[model samples]
Target chain A: MSTEDILKQTPLYQQHLSLKAKMVPFGGWAMPVQYESIVAEYDCTRHGCSIFDTSHMGEFFVDGDAVKSGLDFLVTQPIKDMPLKTCRYGVMLNEQGGIIDDLIVFRIEQERWLIVVNAGTMEKDERQFQKFIRPSEKFANRSAEFGKLDIQGPQSRALLNGLIPDIGQLAYYAFDHFDLLGANVLVSRTGYTGELGYEIYFSWDRTPELWDELLKRGARPAGLGARDLLRIEMGYSLYGHELEENICPLDAGLERFIDWDKDFFGKTALLKKKDSLDQQKIICFISESRRSPRQHHRIYDQNQELIGEVTSGIFSPHFKQGVGLGFVKKELAKKGDTIYFGDDKNKLPAEVVSRPIYKQGSLKS
Target chain B: MEVVDHYFYTKEHEWIHIEDDQATIGISEYAQEALGDITFVELPSVGTEVEQFEQCSSVESVKAASDIYSPMSGKIIEVNTDLEEKPELINKDCYERGWIAKLELNALEEQSKLMNAEEYRNYLNTLE
Candidate 1:
């Protein structure tokens, strides 16, 4: 299929083109891969402010009391206690204990909630919500009605404060309604990149204006390439990679998000797997060599025995090294173990280090 | 974009500079620009024999990996060891210092099958 035929365009598509972004297919959307260069854009995000078009993500509105609406039982994270204007990060699992998608739940009001999901899994997520949410409760899939943009970096707050004076007060994981360009929009202090940033959800029709306004304020345009690198540097899992239909939260190192104390889908199966898990999905690593271990690259022990495989790998611009996220046998998932990655033609030495390969982030600041 | 007047070009964006029985090879500037910030370059061993248009080496950028094809059949006489430590050199100067390998040409006649510098520039325009 032609690039435009299979890919959906965001409101900022023209903007990206205007900036000479390298556009590529990502999650069935015509997304920008880079504006100037991936390394340059990555640096811009780490050191300055960068704006990303995240409109491809799915957004759903759930309206009702948490328990009465079946919203409380649909996700793995505890949502009933989430304060208004706060967001919770968690996963949605199938009956077999495999993850459906990792999602973020935003508490917009006492009876209203907004759930954001991965772009590729939008249809499935909507179907699952429709199937499980009680018919008596009111909800709507508002994915098409909203456009999302993420403004991230150490200078993000300073940049955003120029547009919305109170944006600086929204602490990490918190969100609030603010007036911008004569529209009341939702701005949340949360991001995939481990940088102090905000994810803005605005009216779809107003997105082009917001995008232009942000660029006018000196926020550099970043593409999906930089986004992937930024997230991987933070040890964040992409949906299809670390979390998939065949992987459960327990094996994916997301046990903390799963509330075993309360009932939810896949709870019983997860409990069963928890007892028999031979391998744990964890973020393991390699050195700063330019040689990156790509997806599905076999992970081997010091003795060259295959133990795991990389799910996501990239050359981190900030660290100037190769880093990856992968799953390994439970015993080999330790932080300080040595490992190697192998492909058909090469076997490179590496070491298993802690997640979030680059630690000096402005995420909380 | 820097197609040398005396060099021959391949559709895959490789360039060859032939002098007598010896030929120098590298990817075109357009190819390097498309690849973006090359991080790793897997250079071929010095004595490796390669066929015309065959994959001789691999180049990796932050986003993807691509193979470098031989523009002519030859025996690899010397590989660019500088790329082992500085792959970005390919992005900086893909035509000169970034040349991937030096080869002893086996079939000099194959040079005629490749495009001239002006022809290669025209080919790039057609791609857009």
Candidate 2:
């Protein structure tokens, strides 16, 4: 199908076009790939402030007690204990233990919650929630009613504080209701770029005004191309690439997010496969040269034996080198192991390193 | 999309300026703008023999990688080493400082297959 037919547009579509952004199809959305250049935008986000249009992501609102609403059994995290005005990152899994999607749960109030999910998996995620939580009133899929803008960088908090003073009090993984441009909105201190940033969820129609105001405040416009690079530099997994239908949370190096004490959809199958040694493993690597290892590129050991394949790769402007995250055999997931990444035409040497290759981030600051 | 009057162009968006038996080669401005911010370039080794319209080198932008094709059959006399550290030169000055390679022309007749400034301008119009 044509991208124009399947892909959706966000409220900032006109704004991106005004900046002459390079548009590309991403997650069934007509998203901007870059404004000036990906490298330039990446550098801007690392040093100054950058704004991203994240309105395509799905948002759901459910109203009930945490346990009584079947919310605790739907996700891998213990959400009942989450404080009001706080957000928790977790995953939703299928009965076979495979990941459905990774999501963030926002505790808006004692009886109200907002769940954000990936754009591509919105329909499936909504269906799964509907099937499992047979509530008196169905959970509201409010994805279309809201627009998301992410302001990220070292100076992100200060830049946003100048616009909305109350946002400065928000701690990491916390959110609060604030007034901006005469509208009450939800602002959260969370982001995917491993930078000190805030994600603002506002009324859909007000996005144009917010976009212009943020730009006037000197926030550079960043597109999906730089967004992917920024996230990969932090070793964050993209939904389809690193986490997929056949990949379980444990194999994806997300065991900490899964709570074994509570019962969930994929709990039984995950427990059965927990101790097994034969599983595809997720690992991060850094290239020896500036050459990047692209997605689906074959990863080999020092002896030239094929072991893994890259899921997401990019030339990190922050480090001036190439970094990638991929899945490999469990035996090949050791740190400090030498590896090769390439296609049939060329092969480049690399080293398995710890996740989040760029360590000097202001994410927790 | 600046096309020099004296240069000959290939369908792959490569431009060549031939003087006597030597030629300078680089991607067109249209090509560079389409590729976006070039981060890396894999240059061919000196003395490598290349055929007309064949792939000689590779240029990688942050978004994707593209093969740079040779406009005519020749032997590579020299490759641009400056691109290894600053591939952005290709985006800044594609025609001059960003010249990818110098080829010692072997067959002068291969120039007939390329388009002149006016023909290339019309050729680009067809693409749009």
Candidate 3:
């Protein structure tokens, strides 16, 4: 069979087709790349509002005692301190200190937890969870029966407040269940874009009704193309690019999210490699012009010396330049360092800048 | 899908309106639609000599980049400087306001190598 025939389809596949979305293969699923222009979709999310169908992502539920079920040790964060309605962002590591997946774990209740992971790594992550989770623990993969929609932008709060009651009360990274179109939906004050937004998790079959209602309420339909650009602008790490099986969280520039005070998977290995990180380093950078540096593009210093390779690159609609994340030699990963991308023949000038390149984002507001 | 009747076309989706010795060049509407939101256009420098079907300029869209080939080779006499600040004109109007460059035609015989309005439209149909 061809690629499209073998790829999975999300619940909103027909909706995307009806909207004339340009479908592309992503993470073993046929997903929309764009319904309109990518730049317009990006602007809608950053300035106005946009809704994305993100049902391809996986959701796993585990109900048990944190310590006895080995849930605390399976991830690299302090979940015990997380409030009931809050979610924590962290990674799961292999025994050798390699990243398994970067994910968000929601403390839905005292003993119930919901884990959100990347769509491409869902099967592997499920297998790992099944292996590490205690046989006595209750574990279930609810990815198929769930549908997700990311409503993002500066105007998202007011728009959502019109639909859900007391939506304004939930702080960032907090979530609550609400009634929507006769169905119970889990709405979280969180999103990938640097905006004041919400991620709505509703019943899989009822997703079309939700999507149509949101669009009817003036939310533009954005696609994965715009989502990738928004995440890059915020300097958020993406799986299969910034995080990999051989890439540790520290190497991916995510040390702050790792709680070293607690014992977790790969603790000994991480400790051994932490102080002696002499080779690998990740850095955020910006191109001097609109010429984008694609994935795997080689990074070089002013002296034409090889430094690193680009992991993610995008033509930033806000910055009016190309921004990217890359990994380079630990010594050369310095702020304001002038570097270049591509081979010596077509090297594009760039400057190493601080993370979260787009500072004007309404993410915290 | 706007194809100018008086213009000659290339298989690469470039169109040239020949007026005596001077020819104005721009991308087709089909090309602009495929590109989806042109962000940057690298216009060729004036007084630069080039061959027919040679790389004349390049464009960067929101998604990817593509090169524009010269429909007929000649020295670039003038370039659309307005595109430097506003590349979206190409997406707005690929025919009139979005012209890429003005070339001093090398030879009138080169027109025979390009397609007319009707031929170009039929050519586009084959692609779909």
Model 1 C-alpha lDDT per residue in residues A256-363, reported as the tens digit of each score: 897777888888888889888565768658654778878898888777888888899888766667888898888775677778886746788777788777889999
Ten contiguous residues with the weakest lDDT in model 2 chain A: A129-138
Quote the positional error of residue A10 for candidate 2 in Å. Answer: 0.6
Off by over 4 Å in 3: A2-5
Residues A297-361, model 3: lDDT tens digits: 89999899898899998888887888999999888858898899987678999989998888888
Question: Which digits, one per residue and each the tens of the lDDT, describe model 3 over residues B1-101?
Answer: 78999998999999999999999999999999998888889999999998999999999887678999999989899999999888999999999999999
Kindly indicate the candidate among 1 and 2 with the higher DockQ: 1
Angstrom error at residue A312, model 3: 1.7
How much is A237 displaced in model 2, in angstroms? 0.6
Residue by residue across B1-128, what tens digits does model 2's lDDT show? Answer: 69999999998999999999999999999999999888889899999999998999998877577899999999999999999999889999999999999999999999999999999999999998
RMSD of each predicted structure: 1.9, 1.5, 2.0
Best by DockQ: 1
TM-score of 2: 0.97
C-alpha RMSD between model 2 and the true structure: 1.5
Tens digits of lDDT, candidate 1, B1-128:
57788889999999999999999999898999999989989899989999999999999899678898999999999999999888999999998999999999999999888999999999999999
